[model samples]
Target: MIKMRNVTKYYPNHSEPALAEINVDVEKGEFIFLVGPSGSGKTTFIRLLLREILPTTGEIYVAGIDVLHLRPWKVPYLRRNIGCVFQDFKLLPNKTAEENVAFALEVLGRSQHVIREQVPEILKLVGLESQGHKFPSELSGGEQQRISIARALVNHPPILLADEPTGNLDPATSLELMALFDRINKMGTTVLVATHNREMVDSMRKRVIALENGRIVRDQVRGVYGYED
Candidate 1:
C-alpha cells in the first residue's frame, strides 16, 4: 500500500538530508513499526508519504497514487486513503469525542445521519464508546489518544500512520493502545507507527524498520527494538 524509491529530502541550508535514499514497501494489512531515536527522520518519512512536503528526489506511491506528482488540488483525496495519529492528541478542547470524530466525516461532506451512525461505531472500535460525550480535557491521556484514533479511523482509511503514538502515555496505557492498533490491523487496515518506545516495539515483535541519521539501517521481519532507546 506504500512504496518509496530512492527518496531523498533536503531542507534549506541543512548540511544533511532529512531522509536519504529511502526505499521501502509496506503491504496492505501489514503492521509495521518505524523505530528510531529523535531526529532520525521518522517524522520526515511520514511527511513525505503525506506529501506535506515534496521530496527533493525520488518516487512515492501511497495506495497507488503517485504522491510526488499528485496535483495539489487532489492532495485531500490522496490523504483520504491514510489516517494520521500523533504524539499530541490534537483534539479540539471544546469538542466532545463524538463530535470530534463526526467532524472528520462532516468535512468529507457526509450527511448528519451517516456521521451519527459512523461516529459511534468508530468510538466503539477504539474502546471509547462510553466516553464519547467527554471533551479532551475531561479524558485521561490514553482516553484522549483513543478519541484521536477514533477520529482518524472514522473515514475508514486504508492506511494508518502514527508518529510517536505512545510517547505521552504510561507503559500499561501504551500497551493497551498497541493492542488496539494490532486489532485495527487484523481488521485489514495497514498500520505504520513511528516510535521510540522500545518496550512496546520489542514486545510486539512486528516488522520493524530502524532509522538513524536519515537512513534506514535495519528492516527486519518480526523484529525487536534491538538497540537501547
Candidate 2:
C-alpha cells in the first residue's frame, strides 16, 4: 500500500540528509512498528508518507498515488486516504471528544448526518463512547489518546500512521492502547506506528523496521524490539 524507492530527505542548509537511500514496502492490512532512537529518521519517514514534507530525492507512492509529484492543491485528496495520530494528542482543548471527531469529518465536507452517524461509532470503536461529551482537559492521558485515535479514524481512512502513540502513558495504559491498535489492524486498516516502547514492541511481535543514521538497518517479520535500551 506504501512504497518508497531510494528516498532521501535533506533539510535546508544541512550537511546530512535526515533520511538516506531508504527503500521500503508496506502491504495492505499489515501492522508494522518503526523503532529507532532519537534523530534516526522515524518521524522523517512518517512525514514523507503523509507528504508533510517533500523528499529531496527518489520516489514515494501511497496507495498507488505518486506522492512526490502530487500537486499541492491535490494534497488534501491524498490525505483523505491516510489517518494520523501523534504522541502529543493534538486535540482542541475546548471541543468535546465527539466534537473533535466530528470536526475531522466536518473539514472533509461530510454532512451533519454523516458526522452524527460516524462520530459515535468511532468513539465506540476506540472504547470512548460514554466519554464523548468530555473535553480534553476532563480526560486522563489514556482517554485523551483514545479520543485522538477516534478522531483519526472517524474518517475511516485506509491507512493509520501513529508517531510515539503511547509515549506519555503508563505500562498498563500503553498495553491497552496497543491492543486497540491491534484490533484496528484486524479490522483491515493498515497500521504503522513509530514508537520507542521496547516492551510493547517485543510483546506484540509484529513486523519491525529499525532505522539508524538515516538508513534502514533491519526489517524483520514478527520481529522484536532488537535495539538496546
Q: Which lDDT tens digits does candidate 2 get at residues 1-229?
A: 9999999999999999999999999999999999999999999999999899999999999988999889999999999899999999999998998999999999999999998898999999998899989989999999999999998998989999999999999999999999999999999999999999999999999999999989999999999998898
TM-score (C-alpha) between model 1 and the true structure: 0.99
**TM-scores, each model vs. reference:** 0.99, 0.98
Alpha-carbon shift of residue 188 in model 1 (angstroms): 0.1
CA lDDT scores, all candidates in order? 0.94, 0.95
Residues 1-229, model 1: lDDT tens digits: 9999999999999999999999999999999999888999999999988989999999999999999789999999999999999999899898898899998899999999899899989998998889988888899999999999998999999999999998999999999999999999999999999999988998998999999999999999999887874
List ranges where model 1 is wrong by over 4 Å.
Answer: none
How accurate locally is residue 187 in candidate 2, as Cα lDDT from 0 to 100?
Answer: 97
Which candidate's lDDT is highest?
Answer: 2
